[model samples]
Target: MHRSAPRLSRILACAAVPVMLVAVGCSSDSGSDGKKNAGSSSSGTASSKPSEPTVEPAKFTDLPDPCTSIGKKTIEDLVPEAKKKGGTAGGSTDLSVRGSCSWNGLDDQGVKGSQYHWMDVGFTRFDSDQALGSGAKRATEDYGKQVTKTKATEGAKKAAAEPAAGIGEEATLVTYGLSKTDEDFVYATVVARTGNVVVTLTYNGAGYAGAKTPSSGDIVKGAQKAIKEAIASVEKTAGADASSPAKDDAKTDAEDTKKDDADAKGDAGSEDSPKSKATPKS
Candidate 1:
C-alpha cells in the first residue's frame, strides 16, 4: 500500500506538470499582450501631440509719412491760396502707424467773392494677428467704418456712397452737402484701402459772398485726384525710405573722406616740411 501511495503521489505530481505548463503558456501570452498594448499606447501618445495653429502673414510692415503724401501740385490745385501750403500735420502719437495732414484756404476774386476750400488726408496701418486676422482684412474693415462715419456727418444732406475705381485695391466715395456759415458746403470723402493701409481723404468747398457753391461733381473729382496721388505716394515713399539709410551711410562716408583729405592738406600746409606730424593721443 505504501508503494501504491508513493506511485499515486508521483502520478499527481505528473498531472501538476500540465497545470504549470498551462500557467507558463498563459504568462507568455500575457507578456505578449502587455508589449502590444504598450506599443499601441506609445503610438497613441505620438499621434495625440498637438500641432501649432498658423495664420496668414501681413503684407506691408511700414507706413508712409502723411504730411508729404500728396504732390505739391495736387495740393495747390485742390486748396488754392492755402493758409499752410505745406499742410498742417494732424496730431498723432505714432507717425509710423497713423498720420494726417490738412489744409484750408480762401481764394478771393474781389467783386466775384471768394471760394473756400478745405482738404485733409489721413492714413491708418494695421498688422496681422492670429485672432484678428490679416492686415489687409483689418484695413478693409476700417475702410467700411470710415465710409459709414463719413456718411453720417452732422447736417449732411443727400449723403451717398459709390465705389471709386483707379484709386487703390478698393475705394469708396462718400458725398454730402452741408450748410454752415449761411453757405452751402459740398463735401467729398474718399476711403481707400491699399494692402494693409487705409487712406481717408476729405475735401470740402463753399462759396463766400457772391460766389457760387462748388459743384458736387467737381468736388468728387478733386477728392479722387488727391486720394489717388496720396495712395501712390505711400508706395513711392516706402521704396525711397527703405533705401534712405544706405544712401545716408554713403553720404556720411563721402563726407568723412572729404574731411580726411582736408585735414591732410591742412597738416601738409602747416609745416611745409618733409617730416610728418604725430597725431595727438587722447
Candidate 2:
C-alpha cells in the first residue's frame, strides 16, 4: 500500500501535539510551585518582627565640656607641672553625649626630686531610649562598671573599693597601686552617676628621681574632690546651679528650724493654757 505524503505529514503532527501539551503541563506545574514558594517566603518574612522591652524615660540630654569639668586648682594640685593646665580633651564624635580630658606632667624639682602625675576625667551622658533603659539607670550601670574596671586594672595592687558619699546619687571610689618607671604609683578612680550622667575621674601619681610616692589617702581625697566638681558640672549642663545641693540643704535646715520653733511655741502656749478654766491663783 502507497501512503500519500500529506497524510504522512498529518500523522506526524498529531503525534507532536501530545508531546507539546505534556511539556506545557510540566512547565505550568513548575511555575505554580515557584509561585507557592515565593508566597510562603513572603508570608513568613512579613510575620517576623523583633520584640522590644519597655523602658523608663531618660534624665539628662547633654554632657559637660570634659576639659572644664574639673576645677583649675584641682588640676594644679594633681599635676604640679601639667603641660596643659586646661587638660587635653579626648576624642568624641558626639560632644553632647560623651567627652573626656586628661593631664599628665613631670614636676622637676632641680636636685631635690622629680614627681610624675596624671589626671583624667570623663563624662558620659545617656538619653532615654525605648529599647534600652532610663538614662539614670544606664548611667548607674556604667558607673559600677567603671569602678570594677579600675579595681581590676592589670598589674594593680592593694586594690580597694568603697562607697563615695556626698558626690551624686550613686558613687564608688576605687583605689589601687601599680609599679611604673621603677616607682610605685598610687591611683584613685571615682565613678559617680547623677541622674542620667556618669562621671569617671582617675588620678594617679608617682615620685620620679628620688621623690616620695604619693599617698593613697591624698589621691583618694583629691579624686573625690574632683568628682564632686564634675558632678556639679553635670548638673550645671542641665540648668542646675552649682550651689543647688548647698542651697537645698540650707532651705531644708531653715524649714526644719521654723517647724521646731512653731512646735515649741505651741507647747509653751499649751503649758500656759489649762484645759478647763484656771482656778483663781492660790
Candidate 3:
C-alpha cells in the first residue's frame, strides 16, 4: 500500500509541472503584448504631437530715408524759401524702424506780412511676431492710435478727423487749430498705413506779421499731397516685387491734389489777400 501511494504522488507532481509551464507561457505572452502596447502608445503620442502656430511674413523690412522722401519741387512748393531745402532729419536711434524729416520756413512778403510754413513726415515700420500678430495688422492698430493722438493735440481747437481715400491701405486726415507764438495756426495731419509701415505727415502754417493763416482745405490738400509721396517712398525701399495698389492711389491722388490746389490758388490766403477764415493747428 505504501509503494502504491508513492507512485501516485509522483504522477500528481508530474501533472503539476505541465500546469505551471502553461501558466508561465500565458504570462510571458501577456507581458510581451503589454510591452508592445506600451511602445505603440509612446509612438502614437510622439507622432500626434501638435505643431507651433505660424504668423504672416512682414512686408517692407526696411524704411525709406525721411529727409529725401519728398522731392525737391514738392519741398519747394510746400515750404517756399525754406531755410534748408533738404528737410531736417528728426532724432532717431534706429532709422530702420522709425524716422522723420521736418521743414520749416518764413517767406517774407514785405508790406503783405510774412508767411510761416512747417511740414514734417514720419515713418514707422513694424516686424511680424508670432506672439503679437502679422506686421500689417500691427501697423493698422498703430494707425488708429496715431489718428487719435493727432486729434487730441494739446490746446487744439475745432479738431476734426475724416477718412482720406487714395492715400494708402488706410488713411485719416486730422485738421485742427492751435494758438501758438501769439498767433493762430492751421494744422493738417495725414496718418496712413501701408503693409507694415505707418506714415504720418503733419503740415501746419501760421501768418507772421499781417499775413493770413492758411485755409484748412489748402492745408489738407498740401498734407495729402506730401504724404502720398512719403508713403510711396516706402514701396521704393521694398523690392520691385512689392509694388502694390498704393502706388496707383498715390498717382491718382497727386493729380487730384494738383488740380485742387490750382482751383484754390487765390483762396490759399498765403499768396493772395485773406479770403476765408484761418483754419486750426499741430
Candidate 4:
C-alpha cells in the first residue's frame, strides 16, 4: 500500500507542469497584441491634421489683344504714342471685363515677369475729370503720407523723398514686386487730369529668381509706359471728368426715377379729373 501511494503522487506532479507552461504562453501573446493596438492608434491621430490653403493662379481663354479693343480716339490708342516717347509695350491679355485689358511684359530692368498692367474703360457720357483728379490727388498724397509716416515710425533721421515729376494728374499708378529672397519693391504714380477726361493706370511687378538685381530706376523705366497706357485706356472709356458719379450711381438714379414715376401716378389717380381715368366700359 505505501508503494502504491508514492506512484500516484509522481503522476500528479507531471500533469501540473504542462498547465503552468500554457498560462505563461497565453500571457506573452496578450502583451504582443496590446503593443500592436497602441501603434495603430498613434498612426490614426497623425493623419487628422489640416493643411494650409493655397492661392490658385488666374486662368482665362485666349482673346483679342487689350490694346486693339480701345477706340481709335481713346487714350489707349496713345500707347503707340507713348512708345514713341521711349516706352515699351508688353504682351497684352484680356481681364474678362467687357472693355478691360491686362498687359504683362518686361521693362528696361531686364527682370522677367516684372510688369502687371490693368486698364478699364467706361463708355458713359459722365465727365471723369473730377473723379480722376480726386483719385490721383488722393493716391499721390496718401502714398507720400504713408511712406513718411512709416519712416517716422521706424525712427529714421529723414524720410526718403520723391521727385515732383513723379506725380501726375491723368493716372493713378501703383507698382510693387518681390525679389528672389522675397524682398518688396513698391511704387505708385497718379495722373489726375487729361485733355478730354481722366485716365488711371496701375503697375505691379516682382522678380522671383535671378542672379541679376533690379534697381528702382530699372523698374520705373520698364513699367512706366505700360502704366501710362493702362491709364489712358481707362481715361478714354470713362472720360477726363474724374468727379463723376460711381457706377452704382446709375442704379440709385434708376431707383429714384422709379419712385418719382410711382408718386406721379398716385397723384394722377387721386385727382377727380375725368381725363385722368378712362370711362368704364363706355
- Model 3 lDDT at residue 139: 96
Q: Best by TM-score, which number?
A: 3
lDDT of each: 0.89, 0.86, 0.91, 0.42
Model 3 lDDT per residue over 1-282, tens place: 989999999999999998999999999999999999999999998899677788888887898999999888998988999998987999999999999999999999999899999999999999989999988999999999999999999999999999999998999999999999899999999999999999999999999999998898889889999999998888888532354689979988999999898878755655445545565676
Residue 259 deviation, candidate 3, in Å? Answer: 40
Give lDDT: candidate 4, residue 150: 36
**Model 3 ranges off by over 4 Å:** 1-36, 39-43, 46-49, 239-282
* Pairs that clash in candidate 3: 176-280, 176-281, 177-280, 177-281, 178-281, 186-280
For every model shown, what is its TM-score relative to the native structure? Answer: 0.70, 0.65, 0.74, 0.32
Model 1 agreement with the true structure over 117-136: per-residue lDDT tens digits: 99999999888898888888
Q: Model 1: runs farther than 4 Å from truth?
A: 1-53, 239-282
Q: On a 0 to 1 TM-score scale, where does candidate 2 land against the true structure? A: 0.65
Tens digits of per-residue lDDT for model 4 on 68-148? Answer: 533434333322223222222343332322233333333333444333222332211112133344333434454444344
Deviation (Å) of 7 in candidate 1? 25
